[model samples]
Target: MIARLVARTFGLSIAVTVAALVVAYLYGGPAALFVCAILAILEISLSFDNAVMNATVLQRMNAFWQKMFLTVGVLIAVFGMRVLFPLVIVWAVAGLAPAAALDLALNPPAVETADQPSYQTIMVQAHPQIAALGGMFLLLIFLNYAFDEDRRVWGRFVEHWLARLGRVRHAAIIVALAVLLICAQIVDPAHRSSVLTSGVIGILLYLSIQGLTAMFDDDELPDTLDPAVPDPSSTRPAERDRPAHLPVGGKAAFMLFLYLEMLDASFSFDGVIGAFAITSDPILIALGLGFIGAMFVRSITVFLVRAGTLTEYRYLENGAHWAIGALAAVLLVSLKVEVNEVISGLVGVVFIVAAMISSIRANRADARAATQTAAGVSGP
Candidate 1:
């Protein structure tokens, strides 16, 4: 069962590993291979939560859309965000031409030895803006989940209260704005405007995507009621009678794809910045962190869907969202304070593991109660 769950990912993982090694060899020989391997591991460790979150959404999608995520989606993730996005940033910030930006990325100046500013220097300088955008995006994701009053499963009392407060109009947006304002004050004065603007853009991007999804979505309730629990005034249908899942057509599917890409980009922001700490070679970064890590994530997403893990572990989604909240907070705080990547990764793992344990205990308790009820019925 375990082997089948991860079988698809295994093939892609081997392919990505081979590709990374070959690229590493061509770029900087054996030493580069070791670096690539380490970066790949780092990316995977940091992105396990990302995989879970992806699965949460991806499972809702049709098989065609799921395949698109693995194929076309991978290209967007690897080349679009990992490769071209950095060049675009450098181009915009450093006022370098596209070719020059690419050249700088490919042949980054040595931090200690170079006399002039390099790609890494410029990228680091832009960390405040990057962090703000990614943080705000992630913050909204957490807030949306927290504020979902209809959500039946919850991990904390605060979440329940927050959901209750969701009844207020635009409560999530207001809270997000307030947090963004607080974060802006924590950043350097020079970067204050950039941070605020990027954060607002993040919020706008999220709202825009959500609006688009709502507009494009075509699902509607069934016209009839369930016969099992008949009631003349009943306005609701039984859970089993309702559609198993919302059918996503082409437009809605496309919007979901775009949403996934944006989410991946937000997650990648820190990893991309952190990769500089390892090596500033754009090609190597794409091969090791981008290609290999992304494939593994996609594989894991597929595994989760096939294994029905989300359905089995009811609280797992809550755990992922909680991890996202923690990550968002860390990203925002990182604007003012340096945070270790290990700490960030570990925090996410802790939340997910805790939720998993809670789910396990709940399942066991339910089983014991069922056994008792069955025995009582039989004895009588």
Candidate 2:
């Protein structure tokens, strides 16, 4: 099973690793290669939660969209978020032209020098705004999952109560807004406006994508169908048989693609900023962290879907969302206090591992009960 899962992404993974090594080698040497390897591992560790969340959504998409996610969607993640986004942030914040921003990224000055700020320094300084936007987006993702009234599966009592509260209209949005407001108060006064604005934009972005998708969603059933009216013969049998309505076609797929990219961007914010701690070279950072990391995430999503891992470990989705919530809180807190990346990664891993263990125990208990019932039916 492990081999089969690896086989699906083996070629792509190998290609990405080779590319990373080559890029690192060209940039520096053997030392650079080792750094690239370390960065790849860090990216993978930090993003396991992202893989689970991606699988939860990717499995709902059609085959074409799934392929698009692995292909076109990955390019956006690698280049758009991991590469261009940072440069753009530096450019905007530092008030430098695009060329100057790129130059600063490619050739960072000495870190110890007090005379001028390095690219890393500038990026670190911009973390508050980045945290605000990414934190709010991620918080909303968690809130939506927790407050989903239709969700029948839950792993905790709090989640069940949250779902019950979900009956209140827009409860998720209300909770997210309250959290954002609280987070804003904790941000530096100098960056307070920027943080709050970015957070509101994050909420708006989520709403816009979701609303647009709903508008284009062809499968949404009417609130009430007249019982007296017969079924429309024009509706295809296959369409009727579909157990769930998924976003399909050009417009809906585009909206879904946008949502996926936004989610990827939110997840990548910490990794992108954190990569500076390892290296200051933008090219090496993109090659090592962006390319390899994005590929592995995509591969994992595909593997989970193919292996039916989500179905097998039912609580895993709940765990991933909880980890997302924790990560969001960490990001928000980091605005006021420095947070260790190791702690962030470990929190997510702990939740996922716990959920997996619980699922395994449940499966075993079910099996044992079934065996006992069968034995009882077969009289001694």
Candidate 3:
């Protein structure tokens, strides 16, 4: 079963890892190889919630779009986000020309020279803006999900009140704006403008995507394929049916693809930066993140969709959204204070593992209830 689901992804991942590590080993010897290995593992673990969050969106897309995600999406994630995005950020933030930025990345200085600080130094300097941009986008997603009236999982008193607050028009936006302002207030004066601008842009981008999705909604557009529906022999009731409102494609498909890519960029904001702590070599970082880490994350997303894992684990999506919320908070807070990436990663893992356990118990309870009902009816 595992082999059938993960064959292609696994095969691709292995090939890439071997090739990348070989390059690393040749370039910088054992140290480089080891660093690459650690980076790949770190990225996969840190991005566990990212995989779950991605699956939620991908499952709503059709087969063709899904392939695009695995192909086009990977390219964008690997090159656009991991490679070029950082260079662009350094150029914009540090006021360097394109060639200069590439030089800074390629042949980083031994020290933070006065004239031109190292690429990693520039990246560290740019963190607040990066955090603000990603934080706002992700925070809106969490707030919208939490405030949704249909949200039935992880119900507590807090959720009840959140749902009540959600009834207000544009509650997510209101909350996000308020949080953004608060983040602006406390962040260093140096980063205030950049953070504010990035945060606002993030909000606008999110709004644009939602508007496009609504505008492009048409029966003529391609309807989303239920990834599980192709198997006629599958007995899982959850996989037997499609969502009541199927997602439409065309312009919306392209928009969703864009949204997914941007979502990945937001997630990678930390991973790319954090890789610097291990090694400052641009080549090694790319080998680990772009080639290996990114590949496996895409593969894991495909596996989750095909396996119907989300449908089976009822609360898994909730946990992932919660993780997104935590990440958003961490990102926003890091504008003022340095927050460890390990802590950020662990928060998501804890939520996901707990949710999985809850799902297992819920499934067992459901089974017992069904059996009891059948037994009671027969006895009568």
Clashes of each: 0, 0, 0
Q: TM-score for candidate 2, please give it.
A: 0.89
Best by TM-score, which number? 3
Off by over 4 Å in 1: 109-115, 219-244
Q: Rate the local accuracy (lDDT) of all candidates.
A: 0.82, 0.82, 0.83
Evaluate model 1: give its lDDT: 0.82
lDDT tens readout by residue for model 1, 220-244: 3234433442211123343223334
Residue 378 shift from truth in candidate 1, angstroms: 1.0
Q: How high is each candidate's TM-score?
A: 0.91, 0.89, 0.92
lDDT at position 47, candidate 3: 90
* Model 2, span 132-203: residue lDDT tens: 999999998888888775553445478768878888999989998898888878877999899999999999
Q: Tens-digit lDDT track for model 3 on 240-262? A: 45334565456767777887887
Ranking by TM-score: 3, 1, 2
Once superposed on the true structure, which residue ranges of model 3 sit more than 4 Å away at CA?
Answer: 218-243
